[model samples]
Target: MRSVDADLIRQPASVLAAAISEGEVSSLEVTKAHLARITEVDERVHAFLQVTGEAALAAAELVDEKRRAGAKLGALAGVPIAVKDVLTMRGVPTTCGSKILEGWRPPYDSTVVARLRAADMVILGKTNMDEFAMGSSTEHSAYGPTHNPWDLTRIPGGSGGGSAASLAAFEAPLAIGTDTGGSIRQPAAVTGTVGVKPTYGGVSRYGLVALASSLDQAGPCARSVLDAALLHSVIAGHDPRDSTSINAPVPDVVGAANRGDVRGLRIGLVKELSGAGYQAGVLQRFNEAVELLQGLGAEVVEVSCPNFDYALGAYYLILPAEASSNLARFDGMRYGLRAGDDGSNSVEQVMSLSREAGFGAEVKRRIMLGTYALSSGYYDAYYGQAQKVRTLITRDFNAAFDKADVLISPTAPTTAFKIGEKVDDPLAMYLNDIATIPVNLAGNCAMSLPVGLAPADGLPVGLQIMAPPMADDRLYLVGSALESALTDKWGHLLIEEVPSL
Candidate 1:
């Protein structure tokens, strides 16, 4: 690999795009640099399950040709990105980190992937993820866990760990992550990256393999707020194919990011998310962020969302119930993995055997929990009550929004933990999303950007900013403002501190 290529992988997507457009660099060179970076570091990180070097080069070449012809292009045209395997692409295999869909490649791209192509972004390949976006850490992947780039022994955070890790490892400049609970933000938090969870229905979910149809929203993961905003613009818009998609104009995220001024914003700190069970380092950094925001003329106030206390309980019931239903189609009768095909076995027996062999322990655990919760005797006691809790959570958010223009919190309770530290302890694992879950529960927009490093572990801490649904531009404005202030304070980007892979 060229030494110059080494520098290209480290540059942000926005800079690369400008360089490519201005003829200071070719798109093919940038794509090749990232692909080479992946080849150099991915085995140690296990961030990508697959890498499409040839296809990325071809796409980059097409963008270069267009630029030479003086054709108008999308703002992010010719940038390279890593896609979380949960979103389907026309020719690439999307495993969703489950054995059931081992080699299945969708014939058509998801709305997000289609838009990326329309914008001329090169797809490096699908990154690994937790099985069907199920786990808080990437340990649930059938292919094996994705290691943290900062410390390979620790996790990069989950469901979307591969997406986060790929960015941290400098394998890709931008990535896509789906947030159901805290999948996107938590991973970004632990990995020292930027993750955005757009308002529910803000980004189309038609082609995203659903974990919970009501909660899943796909958004961008990047090394900076502006880079994430650039990506958020490309992938987010109303899609007629998605019933849950919001039929509204996309927010002015790019403009908000560029403006990056929070002079008169009211930033609220969720009372329920603070204190107790949170690490000292995370809290220290969060408090510092609040002070910094205040210095920038943004007012910080404490707001209560009492119903948020019960969000964890409600999300578990809702996600598993939806997951059980969505995964039913992956039985022996369908297109994915098949098992127990002896002629003597009945169809029912074959179906049971196939699922038994295909699913991982965590996936099966959730399926059983969902089945029991939805059973005739327990439906009202469990699932019905969970829905009530979800409503209360949403109402709490509405009240909180009335108090302040945006909400703030530490993205996760702590920084990156060892890979196997909480894998066998499901409750401890579930607690990681406590700070981020309520946003998904309320179907609003939120973002996690690096605030500073924790003194205790010397790992990154993320500051989460939230806004009311459809007011997503607020998230970008606040996030970019805070990001700019933090970068200035530290005299460098947080990603600069990551250890060389």
Candidate 2:
């Protein structure tokens, strides 16, 4: 392989797209550089479930052809990206990190994937994730856990860990991930990347495999805030197919990112999202970031969202109920992982056998919990009450937003934990999303960007910024401002500090 332009793998997606468009470097070269990097490190990182080099090269070549012919290209044309396995891409195998759907190839592209293609971004392949998007750590994935690029022994964060890992590992400049109770933000927090969960339905959910229909939303993941904004602009819009999708003009996120000015903006620090359970070092970095934001002419004020305390409990109940219903379609009679196919066995027996052999422990636990919650005489007590808590959380956000333009918190309570540290302890694992779950519950948009390394472990720490629903541009304005200030201080991006894998 050519060593020249090998550095392309480390360039941000924004930079690569410009170079490719200006004819400084062909799309094929940039694509090859990233594919080679994936080949070199993915064995250890295990970020990719599949790598479609042949198809990726073909797409790149087409982009080059379009440019040479003076044809109009999409905004992100020629940039390579990774897709979370939960989104279906035409003919690409989407396993969602479970064995039940092992070899199933989706017949058509999901709305997000279709948008990526429309923008001329090359899809590298599907990424690994927690089985059925059910775990805080990627260890629940049937394929194996995605290791943290910062420290191999540590976790990369869950459900969307592979998407965050790919960016940190230099396997892809941009990737897509879904956030259902912090799947995208928590992973980005621990791995020192940028993740966005746009307001629920800001981006259509037509093709994303459902974890929780009410809470699931797909967004962008990248090494820098600007790149994430660019991807968000490309993929966000209403689709008639998704009844939940918001019908409105896409926000000017890219413009907000470029401005990077937070002067006179009202920044609220969520009182309920701090102290006690939070790691001291994480709090230290978050506080320091607040000071920096204040220094940038933004007013910092304390705001209370007391209902956030009940967000986790409510999220667990709501998500499992939806997941149980969504996963019921994957029985033995359908495609992928059919077991006990004997004439003597009844249809019920075959389904029981297939599900038993195919599901991972974590997936089974959620399914059972969901079934019990929805059972007769228990619906009102569990699922119904959880919905009431959800309403209360939204009301809390509404009251807080009345005082502040945007709210702030630590992205996660702690840095990346060891891979096996919390696998056996579900309750402990769930705590990692304490700060992020509230945004999902309220259907508001949020972004997680690296602030600095935690003093305790030298791992990355993230600052989460939240905006009211459809006010997503507020997140980019603040995130980009804070990001630029931190970079100036450190003289480099937080991801630049990652050690060689």
Candidate 3:
């Protein structure tokens, strides 16, 4: 057998899938190459919480056997992909980076996992995440933070940091992520990968562990726009099990990616998202992306979504209240961690003690804030009022969409910050998602793709493209255009600039 080239791991998933389907390489060889790559750099990246090498190899073998037997295969067959830890995979330890569920192995696969299996994608094990998907940086994880591959001292943007970092570090070609606020996009922004939050119900939520139920939506993460669209095509569509799932056809995402044309498309620039608080380097790259889009024949105009100003405030209150309700099931009597059960304490005492011991500071803080907001005395003032603001934000999106086919902004306020910089200050940490929160509130689709590296710090920067609800195709249309233009200017993908480990 020929030796697996080291550069094989660096190839995009689209290229790998084609190679596997055309008999250019065996599935096991591809899987082993990625596993070897993981071994080489994962210590510094810390992208995965667990590595399912045995299972991955076994799955890859099945794909090879199917090809030998002349059976038809899915588009992504034999591709190795990382799963966010928050999504359940039957019999796999599905820790959402919280000690409360540390050793728990769910008995069922999430809708997303089941889809991946059906598509014949090899599972590369679960990646790290913020505890209960609360923090903007992976530092809130109980296990420890995932370091950015670009700069070891900085954070890989959170909640889905592990997923994005895996792509940036070349540990995996494709990964899964959930966006409740900016978990998916923010991480992709900082890590210089591609992440998309499909229209709220365009993808099923049956298997994603709920963060803020209304805001949570699972999407694809990859190194390129086309790769993300391919994965998105496979995992999307209506599922009868999830009541909130939209009973509609999935968009032609792959087609849009292949189209990659922005001609005659009216792209809106969100006024409220780009001004003060944004870093200088971030703004510079963002302005360049706008010019690139305009050069591609995209008509750019400034549009205001004034209610976006309250999106952050409303998101905090709403997320906590829903999280408080969803997490109420983790009492000591359940399958997760149980503490103070010496038979000397009451059931309630054990439950309280278990929760106190299991949750991290950020989780505990949110739970408390949620509990308080939902209390009878404050319900009308806090939670109710926040819901009203949510309606206004949605209205703002509706109005903005009337004038533009898509909206663009810098995916985040700044490049990846040092790991410990904002961990201590909750308010500072919450501000990281400010630019991403409104899309969630409005139940729209959005994506973040690398624009260029920040000139000052030499870190990757991302540009966000948001589309109207169910018009997810528009995101791909613009994302692929800019991705191609930017790649031409840089002479290579931004990820190629990652320092050697």
Candidate 4:
């Protein structure tokens, strides 16, 4: 076994993979190092819902054995990674941080998880998330919220917060996250990690727990753009099992990430996503990043996505409406927790009671909101109207892309907020995704990379790069370039500045 340091844990997945491939460290050692990290800081970070130590060690041992036998391996082989709870892993507990499915172990692996296994990556564990992937801050999680590693009192962002937190905390080199209304990117933004929401169909949805079917996308979360591209290459491809999976070649994201050149690229700053509503420090860092891009010879321009203002309203309606339909399968009759099953109660009563007891306030709120929007009388007025707005948002992206190679914005209005500060304020909580929701509605590729820390809050601020749908490589190309420039200026990545637990 090779001795490992905090520096080993701090290295990005790409560096870890190279070390393992070069025989400087065995996969088992890497896995043990990460598992040790989970043991060390997870109590404070609460990033994981459960840690699959034995399974991870076994998987790492296999990678080591194969390496010793001189067998060819995937580029990310021997790296340990975390999976957001929304993705099913065979026999692993995947509650989505909701009590409705408490004690449930998935029977089979999701397409993404299967791909990770095939690549010989060690699955460290499942991370915590908002119940049913519903909230902007992870405080909606049934298992209690994952605290920001930067400031323990603050949130780690939502739905995919645990995945982002784990990477920021250095508990895992890479993680998988889902973006339905910015679950991946928003969390990445506040946590100072790199998160990419691949083009809607670029990654398979099969085996991912449905939140809003059309809006849901599984993507990569890592600490660096190149590391994200490495993980992206492993999980992205056509999956016959998923009807929405695009039957096309996965974009050369790894190559694009390596290129890291914005020279002659036209970068657009979205007019609607920046300015007044954004936090002063967040906007300041974002503007500075834009200046950095210009210094790198990228052409900068302002593009208006006028329809973006309505994205949040439309997304709330569409998301809840779809979530209501998707979550209907959790009735007491089949699986998961069942309540009011006493002989006196009817089956319908049992189902109703079970749902009432199982779901949290936030989940129930969305369910009811969705139910109302989808109700016969209101469908056309609410859900139907929201879809029209969705179309407009898509058009906005299309028009913006025509003017610029990529669109940019501050990933969120602000950095991580105190956990309970906005939990009681639903409107405020939802506002956290203001900049990120438009991309989901448009069904395009977008990424959030830490540009710097907000001086006021001393927390991470992310710059979002959105590319035209299916041109996912552009995100990596721009994100890597910005990441390099920022790193050079700061002398270290933003996450490195995190106060020690």
Candidate 5:
């Protein structure tokens, strides 16, 4: 058996699928390669909360047996995929990186997990995440922080940081991640991986532990756009179990990836995102990306999304409010960690004590803020007004599409920062997603791709591409085109081009 390098694990899923279909490698072999890589590198990266070695090997054996029997296989047959802990996987402890759900096993799989299983993917393991998917860095995980693979001291972007970091660290070829405010894309941006947050409702949320019901969305994180698209196709579709799941037909994302032509495409550059908030190196890389897009014949146009300025404030208000309500189910009686108090204590007392011991400070703070936001006197002033602002943000996206086929921005203000840099200031950490929050507020589709390395830190920076609701295919088209052009220019993928640490 040949050893797999970091670059091999970073290959597009299509290439791996072809290799598997041709009997070049057994499913078990591929799974073992990834698992071995995880064992070798993950201790330093901290990408996974749990590594499902036993189950993954068994599943891979099934795939290999089926291949030997000449049975048909799904497009992703034999691929290893890491799942974020926020999504429920039956029989596995689905701890959303919170101490509260430390040992709780879900009774059923999330819709996305079911789809991956049906696609014959090997479930590598559940990756770490921020508690309830709330923070910009995975440092908020009750378990521990997932370190950036590029520089061990730096942080991987969150709350999907572990998934992104796993790919960057070559622990898994593909991963599933949830995004409320940039959870998928921001992490991908920093890790130099590809991550997509599809249009809200495009993918079913059934069995996913809700943080902010309206904003939370599950999508793919991978080393390339095509790999992300391949996973996206398997996981997206209407599901009756989730009322909010869009009934719209899922498009051929893989086909879009193959098309990779951005000629005559009208790309919108949001003026609001290009200014003071962004790091200067990020801005320079972004401009270079724009030039590359133009070189590929894309028509770059400035588009104003005025309401975007208020998106962060509105997002904090709405997410906390909804999260407060969704998280109320964690009271001691139902499930998860219970305080050691005796049964003689009142139910309210037990619940309070359990939450105090279970939740981290950030989670508690958000819960309290949410409780207050929904309180009588503040309802209209906070939650009510935030909803209205959400409407306005949605309108801004709708109007932008009138002038452009897609919108673009720097995925994050800067590249990966030191792990503890923003941990002390919650507000500063939240601000990291400023470039990504409006997409969730407006229910649009967005993707982040590595554009180039930031000069100051020589770390990778990502360019974000977004499309209006249901136009997810356009993002693939643009992102694939940009990725192709940029890689050709740089002589390797962005992550590959990084200087060895």
Candidate 6:
């Protein structure tokens, strides 16, 4: 067997699956190659919190046995996928990159994890993430930061930074990540990978550690839209275990990917996102992407979702308020790490001490803010008002959909920044997701693909494509079309064009 390099890992999962099925390569060989690649590159990138080597190879051996037995296999049989720590996998420690839950393993698997296993996908391991998925940069992770593969000193965007960095570093071809406010898409944008946040409730969240219950969603990260669609199809559908999981039938996203042209497709460009707040280089790349869409026969139009101006504020309020309530379950007695070993202290002292020791600074800050926002005197003023704003944001998206099939924007205001640059200022870091948050609030589907590299810093920029509720197939349709057009124009995938380290 040949060694796997960055270019080889960039091949779509479908191609790898085909090769594995034909006996061109054994599942064990594929798993070992990915593990070697991670060993070579991940130390500098800090992409994974844990690497499940023995278990992954053991699963691969089973896949090989099934192949030899001539049994039917899943579409992604033998493919390796990096799972974000936010999703629970039985017997694997799911830290969610928080010290509070360090070394804690769930008794059961998340719906997405189960689906991946059913598909015969090899679980590479848990990736690093922001503590409780609270920040836009992975610097807040209790385990440490994940660096950008493009430039080791820069960020790879966050919460899903580990997933994005893994793809960029050629550590894995497919990864699963969660998005609350641009966690998946932003990381994909900066790392030059394709990341999709399926329509809210499209994928079940049965064992996912909650960040913001109403807004958090998990989806696929890969090098192409088709791969994302493939992973999305397998994991999306109704799950009886999660009450909020949508009962609607999962669409044939792969079929949508096969629909090549965007001819006569009405693509809306949100005017608000392209304005002053956006970096000049980001806007340039965004405009170029729009031009590519037009050349591909898409009917591009400028649309305004006037309520978007308030989205950032609304999200900050709602996310923290919900996070405070959801994270309250992490008392000293229930799970992983516990502080204050002295038995003389009261129960309340033990709980407080554990939290104070376990949580990082950002987590503490958010908890305090959330507690204040939801407190008696401020509940109506802060949390209640934020809910009203969320309603208005949803209305704005609804009105925009009436005019266009989908909306587009720059996934982030700027390209990947240097690590530690925004770690001190929570507000500044949160602003990075201004454009992507509204979609989550509206329970719509969205995806981000590398549009082009920004000239200012030479880092990749991402173009975000969004669709109305349950219109997830449309995102894949447009995203695949745009990806095909852009890659053809550049003569390579965005990540392929990056300067090799």
In order, candidate lDDTs are 0.92, 0.93, 0.94, 0.93, 0.91, 0.90
Clashes of 2: 0
TM-scores of the candidates are 0.99, 0.99, 0.99, 0.99, 0.98, 0.98
Provide the global lDDT of candidate 6 against the true structure.
0.90
* lDDT for residue 228 in candidate 2, whole number 0-100: 97
**Regions more than 4 Å wrong, model 3:** 1-3
In candidate 1, where is summed lDDT lowest over 10 consecutive residues? 326-335
**Candidate 4 at residue 271, lDDT?**
97
Off by over 4 Å in 2: 1-3
Give stretches of model 5 more than 4 Å off: 1-10, 498-501
Candidate 3 lDDT, 355-428, residue by residue in tens? 99999999989999999999999999999999999999999888998999999999999999999999989999
Instruction: Please report the TM-score between candidate 6 and the true structure.
Output: 0.98
As for lDDT, the candidate ahead, 3 or 6, is: 3
Tens digit of lDDT per residue, candidate 4, span 1-501? 134667788888998999999999898988888899899999999999999999999999999999999999999999999999999999989898889889899899999999999999999999999999999888999999998998999999988999999998889999999999999999999999999999999999999999999999999999999999999999999999999999999999999999999999999999999988899999999999999999999999999999999999999999999999999998978678999998999988998999999999999999999999999999999999999999999999889988999999999998898889988788988999999999999889999999888888788999999999889999999998988998899898888898877
Q: What is the lDDT of residue 416 in candidate 1?
A: 96
* Residue-level lDDT tens digits of model 5 in 1-501: 244645456566777887887898777878888888888888899999989999999999999889889999999899899999999999999999999999999999999999999999999999999999989899999999999988989989999999999988878889999999999999999999999999999999998899999999999998988888999999999999999999989877889987998999999999888789799999999999999899999999999989899999999999999999999999978789889579698888889999999999899999999999999999999999999999998898889999999999999998999988889798899889999999999889999999988999988899999998888999899999999998788887887764342
Task: Mark the regions of model 4 whose C-alpha exceeds 4 Å error after superposition.
Answer: 1-3
Q: What tens-digit string does per-residue lDDT give for candidate 2 at 96-134?
A: 999998989989889999999988899999999999888
Question: Alpha-carbon error at 373 in model 3, in Å?
Answer: 0.9
Question: How do the residues 337-428 of candidate 6 rate in per-residue lDDT, one tens digit apiece?
Answer: 88887979898998999999999998888888889899999999999999999999899898888889989999999988999899999889
How many clashes does the backbone of model 4 have?
Answer: 0
